[model samples]
Target: MKRGRLALGIIGALALGLGGSVVALRAGAGETDRAELEKRWADAPSRFVTVDGVRMHVREEGPANGPVVVLLHGSIVNLHEWDDVVPLLADKYRVVRFDWSPYGLTGPDPSGFYSTPRSAQLMDGLMKALGHDKFAMVATSNGANVGLEFNRAYPGHVTAMAFSMLPLERPSQTRKVDWRLKWMLEAHKAVLPNWRHREFWRLMLEDTTPPEFTPTDRMVDQITEMNNLPGALDRQAQYIQANVRAFQSSDVGAVAEAVRVPVLLQWCSFDDVISQSADASVKRFTNTKVDVINYPDLGHFPMWEKPEKFTRDLRNWLDRQPPAPAG
Candidate 1:
């Protein structure tokens, strides 16, 4: 009886302390200085469209008549991931870059409907709204898987496809060797106490790329700001948990064997997330000739780390491909 009373007293004290702290914090943050808050959100890009009542943010450039290139950014990154590459491609292709639903400036899916099929449907609507019938595509990591599913679902719409740092299958060498083992090793090293800490912006930027190509301070700041937006972190966590299966289940070999359009598979030799073995496996299934570009020192984000090389290779590949026949 005495112990039970003591436990209750401790619980009450903790509750009181927590409640007081919350009240003090709220009082200190009253109204939030509207001008300052506005300045903080000032860098967020404008919205392009609202599909199914969810706003989609896009950044478009280049001549309207030029060939279209739809860019799909990786998980946790906004369209700005293509900032360096887009400008270069924009002059040649009508470049359309957008934040996926429930990411970046687009915000979260209020209905909790986040999946590859749903995202693909949203992209289909977005492309039509933007007056595009067929377009080329470039995607990395989670975006690459989304692009693959999109291409499979809408083959008539995607003309050519490029994938960077994408996993091919579940329980493969990459999955077993790269992710699972690495996670365990890192955990043993005490590098991250929790998976959420693994998502830290500084660690992602610093640890996942070539030293020479570390993201600029401005780029890091932009990414971090987007991450801190209301509901952004939660949305990212949900996306990772929900969509990781897509990466695991992706039959890149089957897709490659079935793909009729030209394809490009690029990877960084030192990629920490998706292993090079997976790249080799995916390459084996291509019906059309695969243009494999390998970067030795870069990590998972080769597009950002080696923008010039990636752009040049992409342009060369695009130039060599025969134009699509008219419908």
Candidate 2:
């Protein structure tokens, strides 16, 4: 009995030691990968346009003659989140997408302009630099916050606006993580071993596809690769910690009240991040016939989940708006 107890103690210590080593190794790998990704971004194709003494990374696509539409991605996601949406809209409109300062390939802002108001100012400068005096805006999540602020500051430039999966009010409590993080952390329990979460992946692919089709493996890889960006998770965590109040305190009511431009508020009924109650608040601010489209099957990333439907709906909405006044 004494010998057996001693062996058990030894085994426990060994197990603890092994676990500690594994964690240390993982920490080291994470640091190395993050550095590599930052270096890669150094050579990435980006235009540094001066905005309020800060140079912001910007990218534009499609015809110079086309109407301008600025696409703003969510907190962690860069301009690439709109990759699928941009091509569909590009034929009709010049699509402008950029990593907001301090996230994704854009990296951190050297000028310390990281808040929503500062971001809006940078965006305004970006549009001006692009020679677009007036343009439409489309935003998701935190990007929506910046978009609304930009509209408030420069309503003359924003002709129409579209918002997706955006929170209406500040969360009542702190420490609440975004829906995407919750899903990933939960899914990691089963996903990390195989480096995939089949159910989550399947759902993502199916959501983006048309009603009749399944998404190919390549499509799944394309998305998973984006999510696997080094420091992507860290950057998102930091942004949330630093700016949760901004998201919560976002004056949806104020923006809605002041915005005279056409607006489309697209909310996914099933989204866990931005609650449905938040969507209801938009009506309080605007009677401009707020075009609210609720998708019963979609999640937070609706553009990826239902790309075709999302694009079609967006295009249809844009088509209804009269052309902007020529400068």
Candidate 1: lDDT of 319?
A: 71
Per-residue accuracy of model 1 over 1-327 as CA lDDT, tens digit each: 999999999999999997785555334421233234235533444345877777778767877778888899987677878888987887768888898876667746667878766787788878878778888888887787677777777778888888776755532343324354356546523532222222345556666676676567766665656665555555666666566666566544365555668888776777766644744655655566666777787777777787898888878887776643221
Q: Candidate 1: give the clashing pairs.
A: none
Model 1 spans with C-alpha error above 4 angstroms = 1-46, 170-199, 246-258, 276-279, 283-286, 324-327
Give every collision pair in model 2: 170-248, 207-305, 208-305
> In TM-score terms, which candidate is top?
1
lDDT of 1: 0.68
How far residue 197's Cα lies from its native spot in candidate 1, in Å, is: 8.8
Q: What is candidate 2's CA lDDT for residue 225?
A: 39
Q: Write the per-residue lDDT of candidate 2 for residues 1-327, one digit (tens) a residue.
A: 999999999999999997785565345432324345444443444466666666566777777788888899876456767768988988878888887755555544556436676777778887777788878888987898788888888778888888886655653444345466458657554434223333455565444334555566645543343345544444445556556666555555466666788888776766665543644756655646578887777766777777889888988998788755332
Model 2, residue 131: displacement in angstroms?
2.0
Q: What is the TM-score of each candidate against the true structure?
A: 0.76, 0.72
Instruction: Indicate the residue-level lDDT of 10 in model 1.
Output: 100
What residue runs in model 2 are displaced by over 4 Å at the alpha carbon?
1-28, 32-55, 171-238, 247-252, 325-327
